[model samples]
Target: MPRTNRNGADTKFRAFSDQTRLRILHLLRAGELCVNDLVEIINVPQPTASRHLAYLRRSELVITRKKGSWTYYALAPAANAFHKTLLECLGQCFDEVPEIQKDARRASKLKQQGGCCPR
Candidate 1:
């Protein structure tokens, strides 16, 4: 069962429970990326990006693969299902949320920019 104490799973849940991590998840919703990509896109420092990513990894929300000297992170397959469910819930919550529309636009722009980040 999932733990209720300060165990690994609980700690990971706490990590994903943060706004920053959620934003990172949202960004990763469209596709996979690296820490540098996140840093540039989110306009945060390398350490900040690393912290959020580490949390996501611990939560199994993100998966990392090594490519030579670099590590690329993407939403784990498990995370994809959860993300889909989240979008469905959000869709149910609002008939016309401008914020969601705006976010979609931004995400589109990010994708067009090669996900290198526009920050």
Candidate 2:
């Protein structure tokens, strides 16, 4: 059981180690976003975006909420001191990264346009 928990933590940290996943996390900092919005903002194919989201879900770093036909993803609530600090660090550290910045801009535009996915 101890080993299982440790592996879970390892998976969480590993999720942060990917550039695409990190960009996805950075975007989630804004609020919950549907997969379509994520694909549009990150300029990735649906499969690629969904793959990253699945990784985050496996790591327990994100939670999903279904709203009608669209599912939205958001950062999971901090589970412990470590998780809290990691999320805080993610928000502070990646806010300035060029790629993340570009993602944020695109996300903002998408939101302003009332989202890319149809209701």
Residue 72 accuracy (lDDT) in model 1: 82
lDDT of 2 by residue, 82-112 (tens): 8888899998887888898899889988888
Q: Which ten residues in a row have the lowest lDDT in candidate 2?
A: 1-10
lDDT, candidate 1, 54-94, per-residue tens: 87776666788887778888776643554555545434553
Q: Which clashing pairs does model 2 show?
A: none
Clashes of 1: 0
TM-score of 1: 0.64
